[model samples]
Target: MLALIGEALLAYVVIVAVQILINDGLFGLAKVFVQRIRDLPGVDLLIGAVIKREADSFLRQIDSKRSPTVEMSIKIPEKGISHDDLREEMKQLKGEEVNLDDGQIFAYVYTAQNEHYKAMEDAYLAFTDTTGTGTEKGDTDHETLVREFLRAFMHENALNPIVFPALRRFETETAAMAADMLNGDANVVGSLTSGGTESILMAIKTYRDRARSLFPHIKSPEMVAPITIHPAFEKAAHYFDVKIVHVPLDSDFKPNLDKYRQAITSRTILLLASAPQYCHGIVDPIEEIGNIAREKGLPFHVDACFGGFMLPWVEKLGYTVPKFDFRVEAVTSISADIHKYGYGLKGASLILYRNSDIRKYQLFAYSEWPGGLFGSPGMTGSRPGGNIAASWAALRAIGQDGYLRMARRLMEATLALRDGIERIPGLAILGKPEMTAFAIASTDSHLDILALADAMEEKGWRMERQQFPNSLHCTILPHHVTLVDKLLNDLRESAENVRGKKAKGGTAAIYGMVGKIPDKAIVDTFIKQFLSDVYTCKT
Candidate 1:
C-alpha cells in the first residue's frame, strides 16, 4: 500500500508540472527542448560548418582565386615614389576601377558637368593648407580667383568659431539657406555633420538624451519608423542603445498609417518618415505621420537625405510632391545630405532642429579634460574644412535656377525610363517614385531580376541589386540624363537573356541565396564574414 501511494504521488507531481508548463505557454517548453537539441553533440559543429560554408561561398563568388590561407610578408615603404611615378601608379589603379564618366553606372557618382565638377575640385585644392598655399597653377581667370577666394578658409578648423569666424559664417549661412528652403522659421537651427549617417546618429543621440532628462518613467526608449527607411537608422539605434520598432509598408509601398499608429507605445520617443525612401523612391505620408506624432506628443524626424535637395526644386517645377519639410508642424528635426542631390562633395550633411531648445541636447561639453575645457556641437572634434567649403561652394554655385533645371531634367528622364520599363512585358517600376531614383522588378517569376542584373553587368552597365522582393535600383543623375535609351535597351536584352533561368553562380547567385534564406541571422553572419574577407588584405 505504501509503494502504491508513493507511485501515485509521483504521477500527481508530474501531472501538476505539465499543467504549470501549459499555463506558462508551450512556447517556453518548446524553447527549452530546442535548447537541449542545440546542446547535443555535433550541433554546434554543424552550425559552424554551415556558417563557414556560406561565408566561403560568398568569398568565392567575389574573388574566385583567393586562397584559403594567406602567407604573405609585410612590405614597409621606406622611401616615397616620385610625383610622376605616383601619377602613373594612380592612373594604373584607376584603370582597375569602373569608369563613371561614361554614364554606364546606375548610381554612386553624381556630377553635373565637367565645368561644375572642376570648380568644386579647384575650390577644394585651393583651401588645402594653412599658409594659403594653393594649386601649382596660378589663378589667371575670374573663375580661378573666385575659387581661390572660396578656399581661403580651407585650412581653418571649424571646431573653434571664435578662432575662425568665417567658417562659422559659412556654416550659419548655409544652415539658414537650407532652413529657408525647407520653410523653417526664425527658430530653426542645425549643425553640419560628416554625412547622413552622422546626422542620423546625432538625431538619435539627442532624442535618447532628451528622453533620459524628461521622461524618467520610461525605462527603455523606442523609435517608430517605416521598415523602408534607410539602414543608417538601424545603425544609429544600435549605437545609441535605442530600440527601433518598424512598421510595414502598404500595398502602395508607403507606410501603412493604421499599423504605424498601432506600433506606437508609451516608450516611443521619436517618429520617423522619409521624403522618398531609397528602395522604391515613394515618399511616405509625412504629413499624416506628423499628425500622428503630434497626437502622440512624440518628436517627428523627416529623413530627406536623398530627396531634400531635389524635391523643393521638383515642386517648384510643378511636380506634385508631398510636403515633407518644416511645413509639417510636428516635424521637430530633419536630416539632409548635401553630398547627394545638392551637388556637394561627399561627406557633408545637415541635422536641423525646429528650435534651439531641442538642439541643446545634441551638444557635448567636458570641463575637466586635461587639455582644456572642450565642447563640440557635432560628432567629430576635428572636421575637414575642405568638405564644408566645397559643399558651401556647390550650394552657392548651383543656385535655385541651377537646381530647378537639374530637377526638371532628372524628373523627365525618370518618367521616360519608367515608361520604357513598363512597356517591357515582364518588367515594371516598383512604385510611383516621386523623384529621380526608382527600382525595377520582374513581374514574371521565371524572369530572375538577379540574373537580369548579371547580364546587364556583362554589358558594361552597373545596376545596384536590392533584396526582399528582388529588384534592381536605378538613380538618374545629371550624367545619366542622356543615357536613358541606352539603359533601357540593355535592360531589355538582359531580361530576354535571363528569362526562364536562375542565378547559379557569381554575385547574382550570392544575392539569390541571401533573398531566399529563411533565417535572417544566418544571412547576417554570412554578410559579416563576407565583409571581413573583403577588407582582409592578403599580406
Candidate 2:
C-alpha cells in the first residue's frame, strides 16, 4: 500500500508539471498576440511606452541598468558661454578621438592628405547661416561668400519650382554628370541625397511605392537581394513594411542566380545587386540578375554607393569590370555616393532613375493642410544646402581627371596590398576584388585572424574584421596609398605574433565570441549593453 501511494504521488506530480507547461505555452501565445496588436498603426506611441515599461520592469527584476545619459540638463542657459570656452571644450572632447589624419585608421573616415579637409572646413564656415542669406547667424566672411554664391538660392524645399531655381539647376547638373558617368541614356535622372544610406533608402521606398500603384494586390510587398547586400536595404524594408527575401551567394561570393530566381514570388516588388559589396568587395553578377529582372518585369537597382564614384573611372582606366549601370536593359535605378570615392563632402550621394516616371514616385507632395502646399524630393524637409554646395564645389574642384588620378593611385595601392597579403603564408584574399576595397582571411586554422587583427590594432593599425570566413578588411583610401607597405609589414608581424594563440581580450575576443555565437540575439544584447555603457550619464 505504501509503494502504490508513492507511485500515485509521482503520477500526480508529472500531471501537474504537464499542466504548468500548457499554461506557459498559452501565456507565450497571448504575449505574441498582444505584440501583434501593438504593431497596429497609430498605436506606436502607446506600444513604445508599454515596451519601455516592460523593459524597465525586466531590468529591475534582473538588476540591469540601460539608459541614454546626458552630460547635464538640456534646459536653456541663463548665461551664455564664451567662444574661448566653447573652443577649449571642443578641443578637450576631440583629444579623446581617433586621429584620422594619420592614415592609420582603416574604417569610418576617408581622408586624402589635408587639402580635402581644408576645403571642407572653408565650405562649412562659409555657409553656416541659419537664415536665408543674411549674417543674422553671425559667421565669417567665407560663410558669407558661400551663402551669397550658392546657399542663398536654397529656399528650403526642392519641390517648389518657383523658389531656389538655381538650387534645382545645381542638382540637375550634378545628376546629369553622374548619369553620364554611369553610361546612362538621355532618360536617366536622379537627385542628390544626404548620403549613401539615404540614397539607398530613397531607391527602395521608390520601388515600394511604384509597386503599390501598379500592383495593388501586393499587400505584403517583398524585395529580393543577395546575402552580400548592404544593411541599408534591410533598414528600408523595416521602415517601409516590406518583406525581404535574401538570396544566398555562390562559392565565388556572387549572388547565386538560381537561388535568387527561386526566391522570387508574386510578392517580390523589387530586385537589388551591389557593385563591390562592402564586405568582400566583390561585385554581384549584375548583368545576369538584370537579364532575369528584364524577363520577370521587375525593377532592378544596382547599389554602387561603394564604387559608384570610382568604378566609372576604374572601367575607363581599363579594368575588366562587369557591366552594372544604366547600360543594362533591366536596370531601372542606381544609388552612388559622391562623398566616398568622389572625395566630396560627407553628406553627398545620388539616386538615379531610368526615367522621370519612376523618379516621380520617390517625391512627396501634400497641399491638403492649412500650411498650404508642401512638396519635397527624396527624404527630409529642410534639406541642407551646404551639403549640396560643398558637393558641387568638390566635383568642380576635383574634375574627372582628378578622380581618375585618385582611382589610379588607389588601384595601384590595392594591388600592392593584395600581392603582399597573398605572399603571407596563411593569408589569402577573399575574392578577385575589382576595386580598391578587398578582404584578407586566414587560410590555415592555426592562424587566428581575429587575434592577428587585435595585434595589428595594438600597433595602431585599424583593420576591420569580417565574419563567415573570418577575415580582415581594408579600403585602400588615397591616404593609405603610401602606407601599403607599412600595413603589409605590420600585418605580417601581427600574424606571426598571434599564430595559434587565443584572442582572450579586447575587440578580438569580442569578435571571436560574436563569430561563434549561432544565435545573433545574444550578440545583439551585448551590443546593446556596449551602447548603454557608451551613453552612461554622469548625471
Candidate 3:
C-alpha cells in the first residue's frame, strides 16, 4: 500500500509540471501572434496616414480664415526661373489682405518685444553678410566661428576626460551647479544630453543596466512612475524593453506614494517622480518617495527638465517647494533642461547621477570596432558644439539676477491668468500648480474645453488642448505678462460665445475619438505615420 501511494504522488507531480510547460508555451505563442498582427503589411502605414490627415485637417481648420485664397502656379517652359525673380515671386505669395502684424500670434515669437526682435534680426543680417573665400566657404567660416564658440563654451565632449580636459571640467562644474540648485551632494554626477527626452532615456537606461548588474537572476525589469511623468519615460520603456507600472495621481494631481509602494517588486529597477510635471504642473511627493526608494534600495530619478531652471530661483524668491533633488538620500539622478527656463537656445539639457559608479552604465564604448575605439557618453554622434556655446552664453548673459527677475514676472503673470480663468463660471483649474504652466478644464458637462480653445484661437490666441480629462493648457513666459489682461478678456468673450455648445467638428472631436480607441497599438502606428508625413515636403 505504501509503494502504491508514493507512485501516485510522483505521477501527480509530473502532471503539474506538464501543465506549467503548456501554459508557458501558450503565452509565448499569443505574444508572437500579436507581434505578427502589428507587422502585417499596410496596417501601420494606413493608420499613420489617417492620423496625419486628421492633424493636417485640424491645422487647416485653424488657419482657414487666415490662409491666402490665391494659389500661385508657375509655367516651367522646360526652364527654371532666375533665383532672384523666383524669390520676388515667392514674396508676392504672401497674403496681401491678411494683417501680418506683431504681438498677434502666441509662443512662436519668443522675443516679440520690438527692441529684442530688432536686435536679433540685425544680428542675423550681420552674420549673413560676413563672407569668406566663396559662398559655401563663407557659410562654412560662419558656422566654424559658431562651432568654435560653442566648443569653447562647453569645453568640448564630455565623454573623454583624457582627450578633452576642459570639456570634462565644464561638465563637472555644470553638474555641480545643477546638483547645488537641486540640493544634491558633491558626490552627485551627471551627463549632458540633447534634450529632456534623451535625459530621461539615459536615466532609464542607467537604472536598467544597474539592475541587471546587481540582480542577474531577474529576467524582466519594471519601473514605477506617476502617470503625469513625461511620456518620454514611456518611450524609454518601449525602446529598452521594460514594463512600466503607472501609478494614479491624487486629488492634488501628485502621484500617490502608497500605491507606488504596493507596486514595488524585486523586478522593479527604478522609481520616478517629477518636480511639477508638464501635464497639470503639480509636483509629486518626492521626500516620501525618496524614503521608499531608500528602503527598497531602488534608484530614484527626478524629472525636473521643465521646472529645474525656474524652481531653484523661484524657491530663492520665497516659494514653498518640496525637496525633490539629490538632497534626498534616496534620489539618485536628476534631469534638467537649459533651453526652457534656463533661457538657452534649444537642444541642451543635463542628466545628473549620484556618483561616478552609477554613471558608468550610461557610457557606450566599443573597442573592437573596425573604425577603432568608438565611445559616446550620450545618444548622438557628431554632436553640435554651437548649441553648447549658446547654452553657455545664455547662462552667463542671463546671470542670477536676470533669471530671478524673469521668474518673478512669469509667476506674477501666471497667477493673474490663473485667477482670471478661475473667475470663468464653467471652467475649473486641473490642479494646484505652483509654476507658470497650468491646465483649465470645464466643470459643466455641456461646456467643451476644445471648443473654447478653438474660439480662443479665432481671437488670435493659441492655447494647447489636452485629453484624458479634456482641458486647455497654457505656458506663461515674460512676453505673456503684457497680454494677460487681453487674453483673459478674449477668453471670457470666447467662453460666452461657446456657452451651451457641444464639442463637435474641431480638435475636440478628433481628440475625443482618439482617446476612446481600445487598441493602443493602432494609435501608436498612426502617430508614427503622422510624424513621417510632417517631414515630407510639398512642392
Question: Which candidate number maximizes lDDT?
Answer: 1
Instruction: Report the lDDT tens digits of candidate 1 across residue range 1-539.
Output: 99999999999867865875887678766766567788899997798789779968975674453222211111111232233432343234234334445666543234564787778767766553322111112312313332343444344467765444335545776677788778898799999888899999999999999999889888889999999989999999999989999999877899889999999999999999998899998889999999999999999999999888889889989988999999999999999988788766557799999998899899999987897778899889876565665555455545676677678888898999999999987999987889889999999999988888889889998879898788989988766777899998998888888899987788887886776888999998998999999999987
* Clash pairs (backbone) in predicted model 3: 150-389, 189-353, 190-352
lDDT of 2 by residue, 58-103 (tens): 6566423222121221211223233344334334423333344555
Evaluate model 1: give its TM-score. Answer: 0.73
> Whole-model Cα lDDT per candidate?
0.77, 0.75, 0.71
Ranking by TM-score: 1, 2, 3
- The predicted structure with the larger lDDT, 1 or 2, is 1
True-structure lDDT of candidate 2:
0.75
Top candidate by TM-score: 1
Candidate 3: which stretches are off by over 4 Å? 1-166
Question: Tens digit of lDDT per residue, candidate 3, span 1-539?
Answer: 99999999999866755675587676655655556676898886777688779968976675564444323221111222233442333234222222225334322123454687668655643553222111121234323343334433331333444333334433445566667667776777777678899999998888888888778887899999998889999999999988899999887888788899999998898998898898887778889998899899888899999999888778778877777777788888889997777765457799998887899899888987896677888887645444554444344444566667777888888888899989988988898887888999998777778889989888878889887788877877655768888998998888888988876776767687788899988888988898899999968
Query: Clash number for every model?
Result: 0, 2, 3
RMSD of 3: 20.3
* Clashing residue pairs found in predicted model 1: none
RMSD of 2: 19.7
Stretches of model 2 off by over 4 angstroms after superposition: 1-161, 532-536
lDDT of candidate model 3 versus the reference: 0.71
TM-score of each: 0.73, 0.72, 0.71
